[model samples]
Structure formats: C-alpha cells, structure tokens
Target: MGGPVERPVPEDSAPEQSAADVAPVTVGQGSVDSPSGVERHGMFGVAGSGDTSGFGGLVREPWTAPGAQRPYGSYFDEIVDGLYEAYADAAAAITKVVVERNELTLHIAREHLIGVATALRNDPSLRFELCSSVSGVDYLGSTHRLHSVAHLTSMTYRRRVRLEVSVSVDDPHLPSLTGLYPGTDWQERETYDMFGIIYDGHPSLTRILMPDDWDGHPQRKDYPLGGVPIQYKGATIPPPDERRAYK
Candidate 1:
C-alpha cells in the first residue's frame, strides 16, 4: 500500500548499509548458572548458547573446611570497643567503626588517616599488633569508587581484620601506615605501584616493577591492556584472542 522506497546514495558513493551492519543483540549475564542465561552482549556481537561449563562439564565449588576452636571475647574485646570509641570521639573525621564477620573495618576521611591509624595502632586494648598486608582495588566502573583494603593482624590477641579505606581518583591520598607498622613499607609500595594510591608519609614511593617513566598504573581497571604485535618466525602464531597464553 505504501510507495516504493528510494535509495539516497549517489552512484560513486559508498553502498547503503543494511540493518545487518548494526544488528540488535541480546546480552546475558556473565555467569552460566543464571536463569536469564542465553543472550548476546557487547560491541563484538558474540552470541551465547548459555553454556558456561567447559565441554558440558559441571562447575564445582571450592571446598572450605571448618577451622579450629578459639577462645571467646579474647582480651582484645574488653577495651577494644571503648578504645575505638575514644578515638572516634577525639577525631571528628573518622567516619565509621564496623565489626563484620568477626573482622574490624574502619572508614576514615583521607585527611584524618594519620590520626586514625595512630590511634588504632597505639590504643592499648585495641593494639593492632601487626600490619599484615596493604592492597588497593580499582573500581573504575563500580559505584563505590576505588577502595584501598588494609589487612591488620593482632599477634597478642591472635585475631585478624581488614580495614577498608576509600578515596576518589581525583584526590587519592592517605597517610602511610609505615610509621605505625613498619611491615607496611613493601606492601604500601606495591599498592602505590599498582593502583597509584599515594601514601603521604611513605619514606620511599617509587615504581617497583615498570620503568619509572611509565605513564599509568598498570593494575588499575581503566589501564589499557598492552602487548607487542607479534610476527611469527616460521610457524603460524595465532592472534591474542585465539591463543591461550597460559597453556
């Protein structure tokens, strides 16, 4: 009933592209077990058969055995709460003191890092004996932003906990815990090298791996994946997408 459609391109111009040039696609979640399983997603236009298990095999969850028994309310608990409360009262910028899954997590304003770390390390009852590890996680596309996770273990109380501190990419600065826990020296350096988190009080903040002239932090989520373009000497070298580097 309608009039015939007319082509707009001139004879010498490029051919008119069809809908196939930009086909609509369905996108499924990354997990194979999800109910909304089979769907195509992303710009590459790859389709999904909804199969995540390799070669039709089932995916097995890792085994976690039960742990040994430990005493309740170790001496740390007696004044731990009170000591933290005191520090929170003295420091206005300390944001939160949370105990979740038998672990203590502290959140503080970046500017108050020095005072808070000092309080936690020096507080007699809540004396966090050791700084086990310092690590940073880049959440480039995540809603919560970048989070720097610090793990601290108390040798005297034999308890372990994680302290999560966050800062925006625009202004990522926190006091170095090296002064409070000397063990943080190497760990902080690693975090700095990987995530570009600045430890304001760190003694030596330098690139531990890549050359100092490198432009960006390699471990950040937004960092580009880079590798040399390979030219095979004799045998065919499959492109990066087809080859399994690990194998």
Candidate 2:
C-alpha cells in the first residue's frame, strides 16, 4: 500500500529542562498534546526566570521500557518457550517479557498471577521451585500505580526469574501466592503492610512491620514522611512540616 508514517523530531534550538525543575504532572485532564500525540503536562525550569545554568536546558521525557527481541540469549529463550507451551490456554496473561542486565522479567496481568505462578512452579521443564521474595513498587504517575514483584528461583537449574504484576491503586488486589509457596505468607503481609496491596487469598494478611492502627502504607511515594512530633525528655520536637526546610 503506502509508505510508513514519519514523525517529526524537536529541533536542537528548543529549550530543555531537568527533571528536578519539572513540577508534578497529571495526565488527561489539562495536559497539552504534542503534534506526535504524546501528552505534555506540567512546566519545567523556573516559571518566570531566564536560563543561566546549563542544567536549565534539560528536558525530561516519560520513562518506558523498550521491548526485547528474540533470540533472548541463554536459558531465557528456553524458559519462555516452556512457559508458552505450558500455559497456552492463558496466553493473554503474559503481557510482556523483558531481558535486561542478564535477567529475565515477565510482566504478568494481575488476574493471571496465580495461574502463571502455578505453571512456573509445577511444569517439569520450567521448575521454578522457590518464591524467593515478594516486594512492591509505586509507580507514582502512571495509570497502573502499584506493582508487585515476585522473585522466583529454580534450585534445580540454578536460575532466577522475576514476575511483575501491575494494578491500579484504587483496586490493589492480587491473588496471593501463599497457596503455591508457603514462604510467601509473611512476605505478602509485609508488602501489604507497606504498599497497601491487598492479597485476596493470603492467610492472615495483617500488619507485619507497622502497628495494627497505622494510618497509611508507609512505603508509597505519596505517603507523608513525618507523623506526630516526637517528645524527647519532655521537650517538644516539631514534625517535619514544622521544621526548617531547604528545597
């Protein structure tokens, strides 16, 4: 048919701004759309000042991971092939596969976590026996703000792989891996305690590090850093907000 579409690139003469100089950007509501259809929200650099420092010319673009191409090299290819063959019925669950820094990470859909995990552990060819760790990450700006990471280890093959699942903060529910790996019991609790991700089938999912009445998930980026002021030897020490601060 026709030739491929070409996109225009910004000129070098255009001003740039550093990430630190950029204000927090909210998407979709008031964001400005570029000619290429990418949304640009929030201003960078000093609002009303002229650039004198070299860093003032730096602009920050959105962060995204590039797709990895096959042959993925080494055992990564075998693992993917095995997984695909084993979970052929649930193919949609495996969203993306990434190979970075000699590691393989599978970005899985939240709803398919349990099924994928089960397949990884039981399939003879892909015997990922151990669920080493479970952790959480809050991607501050994206639509899927909460991410749960599960590190899997194959004791039989001496290999490791990571499984990642992303969900919206509004409905942070994931299928608990406790049924597949009992060690994940406490780890899941700890993640829920700090990141507010609710593992639906976790047994006794409660505060592991924080007190039972803790107000918020402490590790989330949007969580407040300071709480009530500390009292030392009957003297009042103000909370972080009341103390002197520097930008």
Candidate 3:
C-alpha cells in the first residue's frame, strides 16, 4: 500500500466541517501483489464471485431484475431471505435495501436493531461472524437524514457486505450490537459522541474525545462550528465576516 492513510479533509466545495470535526481514519501497513485484491489488516483478500455481474464499472449486485418475482436470489439470497423470514417483525423495521459497490445494505429502524442483528448472526446461512465496522453518517439536509451504517464480514465465504440503519434526531434509540459484536463498544461510543445517536444497550456510552461538557454533536450539520464572542488574553477578539462559499 501507499504511505500511511491520512484522514481526509473535505475540499471547499464539500460539506462544511469544523477544524476540530475531522472524520476518523486508521491507516494500515501492507503491500499488494495485484490491483484486483485489497489487503485488509495487511492480508490480501479477494472480492466475492457474485460481485462481478453489473453494468459498466459498477460491481455490486442489483436489488431486482426485470421479471424476477421473489426479490433477489443469489449467493446472498438465502442469507437475506432467511434473515427476513426469521425476524419478520424485526426485519420489517427495515425501510429500504440498497446495493452499491458489491454491498447489500439494510436501512432499518433503531428499535428493531438488536433483534435484527441477532437474527443475522445466528442464522446458518447468513452467519455474519464479524461486525467489521460501524460508522454514522450525517445526511444533514438530505430527506431521510441522520443515518448509521454497519459493515459486516463473513469468514465462511470470504465475502463482505454492508447493513445500513437510520433514525431521526427525536428518537435515535438503536439497540446496541455490543452484545453480539463486542467490538461495537468503541464504535457505538464514537457514534454517540459525534452524532448523538443512542445505543440502548451499550455497556458504557461516553465521549471518546472532546470535553464531556461540549454542548452539541459536532458531526451534525445544524450544529454551529464555534461559539461567538471570542476572547483571547483577556481581550475581545475581532470577528471576521468571511463565510464559506461553495462552487
């Protein structure tokens, strides 16, 4: 791989983020023999087989075909179907299914999260053994905003997929996956810290960074960058009227 991956700061045309509100990124040390595979944690990993059938350069599987009646049925077909079957009520919380970059995402409600996770993990076919990553995205002004996405990997087939779930600000109570994937502890805390999402069963939910007294979630678009009336060295500092303009 290249040099240590640096945390990416958005350009002037990108969404406005505070100097302090940088996205979290961890760089890995590794090398690649071929461009077709990606190295995870310094190990070369191959992409799944079914991921090849798509239009143009697009890789991920499409949700539905022209005449297919029973949803999508392929390598992930049984796994997804079994999940929805086992937890029909819990899975019903899922509002949408999106396929992008060879990943199957489940947009679910917060309340049914734990049940849905448990069902996914326990089911034989969809043995989503590891909860690879859990991160939150702030869709600020977008229609269905304030979303949290969880990426799960399966060791059995050496495949990877994504599951996305969302909740509004008023009720951001997602059932914690810490019990199922113990690693969720830190990710959940980070999500709570930056996005103010509530993980109901998180063993210990606290701010990973920033002072506990901080007023608002920095990741939120509506949250102001800094408080007014800057005072430095016991003197009122002059304010600049320079506002961010995008092209």
Candidate 4:
C-alpha cells in the first residue's frame, strides 16, 4: 500500500501546524430542492399578507466555499505534480487546489481551460483519458456567480479529478472542451441551457433540454418561480411564485 502523501507547504503561508489549528472550509450549501433562504410572502409581487406556514420564521445565512488544507493524501500529490510539469506555462492560471473527501479538485482560470484539459489528457504522467461529465452551478451570492465543473478519470491509474472554472454571470463565456472530449457536447449544451453559461467554442450550443423559444434559463436562482396558472381537475392553482410559500 502507498504511504500517505505529504503536500508541499507554501513558503509564503504560515508554518505548518497541527490539524486542530486549521479551520475547516465550507464547500456547498443547501440542495436544489431545498435552498437556504425562504421566499418572502410579498416579495414575488404578491399582495402583502402575513405568512401562516410555520417555516415563515426561518432565515438563512450565506456561506462561502473555503479552500482545503494540504497533505492531500493518496495519489493527489502525484496528480498535481504531473499537471504542473505538463503545463508549465499555464501554472499561473491555477487559482486554487483543493483536496477533500479523498477527491482532488483544481480551480482553474477560464482562459487556461483548454490548455489545461489538453495537458490533463495528453501528458504521459497524467493520462486522464476520459472527460466524464460537464456540469454547471449557480452560486447565487458569489461574485463569480456561475461555475463550470468537469470530471476527469484516468482509467490507467483508476483515479479521478475535477476541474472547475468560474465566470461572472455578466460575461458567462468559457472555452468549450468539445475539441478534447466529444462526449461533452450534449452535457455542455445542457449546462448552458439550464445555467445560461455559454461555451465559446461549442459547435452548436442550442438548448438541449429547454425549448429554443424559452425566455430565460429556468435554473437560475433569480428566475421567476411562477406566473402562469396551472389547472388540474377543473381547479386553478396559482403559479409557484404567486403561491403562499415559506417566507
């Protein structure tokens, strides 16, 4: 069995200390079905009415994803080193390196995405042969609100790594990985369709799930919840936005 890998401590950072001295970083928050904040009674243009649901008193606090500490054991060290050696020129493009839950995640800048992907695949030491999935996330309160995530697997080493790139919602374009991994075509499109993230070099980035005539990305946090009326069993129901929900 391989011994635990020791990570290189940054010279500029503080001296290495016990794990107890390090504060844990928050990663993700509430799930899509149950987000953190409660929708106000009248905030969505409904008439002013007191909420009767017991959840009305609920309040949510914002939490940011924090970077993880090093000594990221197992094969994480080898993978990071291989990537650094393979793409020396793009070294500066890396923003953060996180190893958590026995997984390695590389936070890369948008401009260097293609180069990084190429190196991750072609580099002999880091033969990440498969680009497993492409997905997107909307960090509602983050400065760079949109995040594109790619999962890569190295069959030879039986290892997996995640590449993440963030972009502001205003300028939501990132270079496409279709050139490297053809399977990402539909996945990227779906992510774009749902999150409004544009893959710059995508051959045809039309909506995969939503209709072409859809007005807006439905998955965005700020998107209107409900306005259209629903009819079932000859009964009319207000749109989700207009309905009385937890405040």
Q: How well does candidate 4 score on lDDT at residue 199?
A: 84
lDDT by residue for model 4 (78-126), tens: 8888888888755555677777778898887766777777778777677
Clashes of each: 2, 4, 1, 0
- Compare candidates 2 and 3 on TM-score and give the better one: 2
**Candidate 3 accuracy as lDDT:** 0.57
Model 3, stretches more than 4 Å misplaced? 1-74, 142-144, 226-244
For residues 163-219, write the lDDT of model 1, one tens digit per residue: 666665665666677766778888888888888887776789887777888888888
Question: Candidate 4: lDDT over CA atoms?
Answer: 0.71
On residues 1-247, what C-alpha lDDT tens digit does candidate 3 reach at each position? 2322333322431212221232111111111000111112211122343423342243332122122234544455665676778676743445455554445666555445666676666555566779989988766543335667798886755556666655557666666778778888899888889999877757899988768887778877666654356456655433222232110
Compose the digit string of candidate 2's lDDT tens values, residues 1-247: 1322232322541112221232222333111111111223223323345654444545556555655789989799888888888776455666677788999988777656776777777777777879999998877776667788999998767779999877667778777888788899999999999999988767799999999999999988778765454567766565553453321
Question: Cα deviation in Å at residue 111, candidate 3?
Answer: 2.5
In model 3, which range of ten residues has the least summed lDDT?
Answer: 25-34
Where is model 1 more than 4 Å wrong at Cα?
A: 1-80, 88-101, 142-144, 227-247
Comparing candidate 1 with candidate 4, which one achieves the higher TM-score?
A: 4
What would the TM-score be for candidate 1 when compared with the true structure? 0.58
Collision pairs in model 2: 16-57, 16-58, 17-58, 17-59
For all candidates in order, the CA lDDT equals: 0.54, 0.70, 0.57, 0.71
Clashing pairs in 1: 26-40, 27-40
> How many backbone overlaps does candidate 2 show?
4
